[model samples]
Target: MDTPALIADDLVVLRGGRKTVDGASLTVAPGEIYALLGGNGAGKSTTLFAILGLIKRSSGVIQVAGHDPEVAPDAVRAAAAYLPENVALYDHLSALENIRYFLGLAGQTRTGAELDQAFDAVKLAPAARTRRVSGFSKGMRQKTAIALALLRQTPVLLLDEPTSGLDPAAARDFHDLLIDLRKRRVATLMVTHDLFGAADTADRIGVLQGGRIAQEWTAAAQGPRFDIQALHQSYAGPDAA
Candidate 1:
């Protein structure tokens, strides 16, 4: 069997001598979209940071593209494309220019036509490609960031609250972009508060509580079905009843 694109087995992270991420385990297979659902302080972002090797893992294993993040941080980074909540871009640069500049920083050089295609793949308007990102809407900016991810063509993708501020239509567009990535076999792990979006986009969903995955659901198992109410209840916790 092919190795999973991302995996965290019994992962733990300590902050101030306390375990913020406690024995959380999950996997994202190639072409899979896994949503890690949680409220604030649930250790969602910490787990992602650990996978990126941004923080020292107090214990357990983390692999990005089959390489340990701690032992081979460079390999893990090369294999993953991360889109944080607020994607940072040069305000003065046009969409095309931004992608070109960042790609060059990663030691990649692509022609103008190829860059245009990447923007197109992410559904960015051709007209907007020449406009400075400083004036772009949140959705437009996100598409630009995703366009860069397309150029990178990494095997693993990490997203944090990717749809936080978008309206319904833009959120839908973002979800569609992720589906396209899935077709290309990019394993995606997203931390989100968007329950409906998670149900709609993820092949599997894991609910995190107190830094551990307390519940998991698979679309295939649900099959043409999803109960947002149940998901909300799970998210609401035992006291919500």
Candidate 2:
């Protein structure tokens, strides 16, 4: 079997002397899209941050591409590309310029043609390439972020509410891009509240409650086999189910 791209075992986090994430565990294999689903304050974003070493874990283990994020942050960062809910970009910089600058920070430099190709792969308009991101819509900004991820060619991708503000068309485009990434054996972990979108795009869905994964479901080999009603109940609470 192939090594998992991301793994968290009995992970724990504390804030204000209270457990925010308790005994949370998950594994995302290469080429698989795993959705971490939950309501607000369910510790979904916190879990992502912990995996990225942005927040220190109180206990448990985390491995990204076989490297511990805390002990080997540089290695983990090199192997993982992260896209937060609101991707920050320079307003004055053009889409292409933003990508170039960010890639440079990662010690990567690419030619204009290569950058343009990445933009194209994300379905960003050729005209938008030179346009300042200040005038771009949320979807356009997300495409630019996706383009950066493609350029980096990281083995693992982490996304936080990636489709929150996107329209149906834009969201669809993003899902297609994820599928393409999977073909390249890139693992993906997405935190989202969109049950239907998770059903449509994720290879597996893990419901988080009280900072723990309370339930999990796998997509059928033929396609997604999610029971939306049950998922809704699960989100409501254990009693609701």
Candidate 3:
């Protein structure tokens, strides 16, 4: 065992007087990329929120980097970087300025050149480096978010809908970035609707249905062939075998 980098044991969450997460348990070791799948309202996002301490979990223990978020929120957040579906940034600020601001908030200051270098890592265009974010596309914004996380150099990452709404080329680049992150030993947990992405990047894919893990699969070693359509069918059908 590599000593789990993230753990959620019997975690539960309630919303609108209903059970959303019912005794969910999960663990992720270092250097592993886990793809979390589920139907609508299956608690996938809830689980991530619980682990991040974004929402108050109703019950169970959640740990990241050996620290409970409730007991040590700063430490837990420091050990992990999260990228939501939409990154909140000042639309008028340049990419470099955005990086400096977040890094400074975390007490890590960056020079202009250093900030540009970080954006370059995610293949941001030089012109965009100094341009306002209001003009940047969704892909550019997502890249900026990733670059910020990369700057933090956290051990764990939780991504929700990372590739959603991106074009084919942009999505492919995003996938490549994630693969590179895995090589750098970042423990990853992604909740995505893109099954192809899961097959391409994840060492393991876990399906969460009705609040419980329904199945687990390994990627094919020789090729990029994953039957996501079939898996989706199986996932949607109540009679899946």
Candidate 4:
């Protein structure tokens, strides 16, 4: 059996005596895209933080590429790439420059040609490569961050609200980039409230409610993969009875 690229089994995280994430378990296999959906205070981003070792877990087994975050944080980090809702880049620096600088921080380097190729893969315009990101759009900044993730070459990716502010056209474009990553054998786990976007892009979808996986749906091998209306109904249902 192929080992999962990311794993969170019976995970629990507490903040000030309250469980932010309680017994949430999920996995993203190689080349798979898993979308986690939840409403406000659902602890979606908290889950990502635990996987990245940014926050300590109260209990549970969490692993990235076979390494435990608590035991080997460096290995876990090396095997995963994270993209938060806000893609932060130096406003005064160009896209290429920002990528180069961040890569340097990670003790890695890419030739100029390689950098351009990464940008191309993310659909970042050639014209915008040298322009300072101070004037870039949300979509543009996102593309640049994705390009950085591509250069990092991690097998697992964790995205938080990836399409939050994107327009319809831009969201579709971002979905295409994610599909491209899947082809490259990257395992992606994204948390978002965009039901339609998840229905469009995810190989599997899970609803998080009451700090656990309330339900899950997998893409069918034949016919329609998901029933959008049904999912919306389930998602729209009250978190508590």
Candidate 2 RMSD to the correct structure: 1.6
Question: What is the Cα-based TM-score of model 1?
Answer: 0.96
Encode model 2's per-residue lDDT on 49-164: one tens digit a residue. 89999999999999999999899999999999999999999999999889989999999998888888898889999998999999999999999999999999899999999999
Model 3 alpha-carbon drift over 4 Å, by segment: 111-114, 220-230, 238-241
Name the regions of candidate 2 deviating beyond 4 angstroms. 237-241
Ranking by lDDT: 4, 2, 1, 3
- TM per candidate: 0.96, 0.96, 0.92, 0.97
| Candidate 3 lowest-lDDT run of ten | 232-241
lDDT of 1 at 112: 79
Task: List candidate 1 segments past 4 Å from native.
Answer: 221-225, 238-241
Local lDDT at 88 for model 4: 90
lDDT scores for all predictions?
0.91, 0.92, 0.85, 0.93
Clashes of 4: 0
Instruction: Give candidate 4 misplaced runs (Cα > 4 Å).
Output: 238-241
Give the per-residue lDDT of model 1 (tens digit) for 170-229. Answer: 899899989999999999999999998988989899998887999998886645646777
lDDT of 4: 0.93
1-241 per-residue lDDT for model 3 (tens digits)? 6998999888888888777888887788888888888888898998898898888888899999999988899999999999988888889898778887898899886566766766777889888877899998999999999989988889999999899899998889898888888888888999988877787778878788767677877667777646766766756675654
lDDT by residue for model 4 (51-158), tens: 999999999999899999999999998899999999999999999999999999888999888898999988898999999999999999999999999999999999
